[model samples]
Target: MKRREFAALGLASLALPALAADAGFDGQVEAFLEALWRLDPDAAVAAGRFEFAPQITLPGSAQRDRQRAFLKHWLAEFENRSDATLSVSQRMDRAMLIAKINSDLWQLDTLREWAWNPANYNPAGPLDLLLNTDYAPLPERLKALKPRVAALPAFYRAAQASLAPNGGVTREHTELAIQQAPGVLGVLDDIAKRAAEAGQAATFKAPLAQARAAVNGYGAHLKRLLPSARRSFRIGAALYEAKFAHDIQSARTAKATYEIALQRREEVLAGMQAQAAALWPSVIGAEAPPADRFALIGRVIAKLSERHVARERFVDEIRAQIPQLEAWVRDHDLLNQDMSKPLAVRETPEYERGVAGASIEAPGPYRPQDKTYYNVTPLDELTPEQAESSLREYNHWILQILSIHEAIPGHYTQLVHANRVPGKVKALFGNGAMIEGWAVYGERMMIESGYGASPEMTLMWGKWHLRAVTNTLLDYSVHTGGMTEADALDLLMRQAFQTEREAREKWRRVQLTSVQLTSYFSGYSEIFVLREQLKAKSGPGGFDLKAFHEKFLGYGSAPVRLIAAEMIRS
Candidate 1:
């Protein structure tokens, strides 16, 4: 059976009502979300649980089911509200709430299907999202573990049922589950030990004991389930098609989307190459092939590192600049809001893992006390030769561009603002394209605004933009099984001007994940077009970089088309 067949079984059209009327529409929506947070404390903490009540224990699956049913019933009761009865803002808030609940329902149902995938099941990903990395004190984290530990039995039982005789559980999934089971158990054990050491309540102590027994039972259950896990099944193409539709959230089929992204990538690459040539005549001698651009970039990086500032110094510089950036936004009245929390720059082991890297770990919807992290990995891991190679590739200009991309006026700042948007549903459906796209867009915007005034800096930014385009092409090529590792490496080396190490790292990332690479080019392209359109539309009114940015982020991270509609309507 194809993957889509399973998706089709779960694909039901979401019902979205027209604008609604009610004097207290906004209040009702807020109350609904507040109630939801109370029921699911993990979500509440994630959504800014610190601001509301103290941390509550997460309920088990049966309790969650009852809560979901109650929400559905409440939504049904409020479904007939018409716009005429409510104020404009209240009506808009209600519509957003309804949309959010529908999206949440879809997510809950879809999660059951993908639950076996280690990416979804392991503590590293979704679990990390809920753990409040930046917010919730250590005591809160310790206290919250009781319910998660308590809930392990129910999770295992669900897994067992899903793996029942002739069910859809695959051998690969079962093997991964088995492999990850020990890690899961270990996490639970760690949590229990921590809670006990912290002198948590008897309520917590009792649950931890129960969790240990349940985990042991789950291990036994897994052995029974493993024997019946099949190598394959008859999931039809229709199901695969449906799944693709839901996952991509676009009208185009996956194949079509891949193709469009491929073509757009080539166009962007050509444009960037032209821009690079014009900006760096001495580096490439004005008529060099696109492949030789990396050598120039490498030389530039090597020169920069020779004079590179220490990490602490660089961070201090960024910290000092924040006040000016923040003031610029306020003076311009961009978005008409202030950040709920200040941004912090941090170094972490995880960020160090990526070869060509930096990342923004933004606050989630439930993460009110969240501190945004702008993580920049050092080049310490590279072999001396690899280090030199990377240095050449990441020159000073490139470093500045990356800083702008990952920190100030980029992902971290943009997301901090995005999280402050008033609606819960908008926050939950945040798309990667908008987030990454805006950052990439910021790099170019800063260059155009003279943030990094040097010709070398401009050229380096062009090179990275070119790489983003190349990434999109390689992602589609490798995943469709059309491009070999060697071919991918050669393309990166030739067109994007990346080192062998950079190329190989990208290949590994593509192998581990699909669809994410496309976001860079897709997002950049959309932002580019939007900027042009905004420029044209505004005329003498002109484009306010601050205003454009604030407005863009205010819409959350939905598709550019939806964002465009919202912008135009507003």
Candidate 2:
């Protein structure tokens, strides 16, 4: 039978309820999301719902209780409607919505990061979004921001009270909150300037000063709590496993994925060793190769890392490489590129910085037409030594790979496709693994297609690939296996061929996050496996790479396993 016919047969095999009488289900979905947006207005603003720009969900029990009730009621409503009640497309949407609701419920009830993670309370992002985005007239945007700014004092105060009742906050999270608290002042200052430009300074002056003081006071409060902030950052095995299931939604368990990553790490290391040996004479002069394979690979990577651009040219270099990447992907016919959707390369905002060096801030599904930002953290802020270390880590070849991952045909491209997807549910509640995995898979696809085809590029790509592999290892080991700082650093710097600066940052990142690090390897591996299986099924001549990609991404940002099942069935 044909694939679509097989998909129909497969759906028929499962006994399901009768279809809904009318379009009531669609209305329910719309109603559910509208309620969700109101309860979580900051998220709504980020998703391009400017109507919620002035709202702020205060951090306390009352708000949590309300959220809990909302989620419970919606969960029952959606659960009441069975798979047979929805159309094929609506089935996918319903499944995604249910998973999103369950994840939120688990987060609010089980994990409870809100009480322990002080970094959860920052107002910088939404405030900055309102101030910076040209979604409306400057005067109107400022007017909407007034209520949110006015609520800052109570927000921080409630944040303080939220922590006291929940035992102690995690020290790392507290430190991060302290580090990022002052950045809100920058947003407030920008608003002040913008308000003045629009001749509305007086309207904003009082709230602006009050917001700044609240931010400053919040920072000081965190500093005072630092010494006593003794809660461990590690969520341990159970929480990590649960979060992996909820956030990643992978087919395999965390332990199983970790084992696969371990095997994959050895394979990558062997490949890097081969490339390093081949380049030894040219890269390291006439000296004999080091007996230890890890040492040999590390030395070659270090030498090649010297070819990176200068500090001032770091961001400029990324911008320059984007067009080249897009051109290459176009010339090669890898995947469809949408040039009309603009991608902006900019410095990472201060508030968003402690997590990752580079990220994509795409316009939410509600505002898909707005510019998608490719944020790269600037090198100027780092000390001279720190700057050089980071530059080396990014280097020439790997820098291109980074661009492939974060921009063109990576996050920027995937997100654009996500925005165009028919339903807003998948776009809003995108699976982390699917989003991250596609980018990781993009890196491999570019390399295999010969974007940079030298042994040096091969070696660097191996090293870069190791970063994803080791990320899974580091996260799994630290959270579940009780991996020490020293062991984690050794895994990154020694085995993974990362620079000292990069290793330390990864170490810090693992503490701040959990399971998210594993998404790279888990998603990439699943996607790669699925592609190979499909290729075999389609036979060599029948398979089309570009078609496969477009079809795979066309399902929106659902979990890879779900996408796999759908694609394979079709």
- How do all models score by TM-score? 0.68, 0.95
Per-residue lDDT tens digits of candidate 2, residues 150-232? 99999999988888533388889988888886577878888889889999899888988888888889898888888888778
| Candidate 1 residue lDDT tens string, 1-570 | 010000100000111223443537656666776677666555554455544333443333565476668668666745766667864335445554565555456545643444333223333222343343535675776545545556656655554544435544555445544555555555555555555666765556677667667656755665666676663422233443344344334434645656766676566555555654555555544455445644545444333445444433544544555565556435544334345565676554341233235666555555434566666556665577776565556555666666667765666666656555545555554555656677777777666766656656655666677777776677666655457778988888766677676777777666544556766666677677777888888897777766677667655555565566556655
Error of 2 at 532 (Å): 0.4
- Please count the clashing residue pairs in each candidate, in the order shown: 20, 0
lDDT of 1 at 61: 53
- Residue pairs clashing in model 2 are none
Model 1 scores a TM of: 0.68
TM-score of 2: 0.95
Residue range with the least summed lDDT across 10 consecutive positions in model 2:
1-10
RMSD in order of candidates: 7.9, 5.5
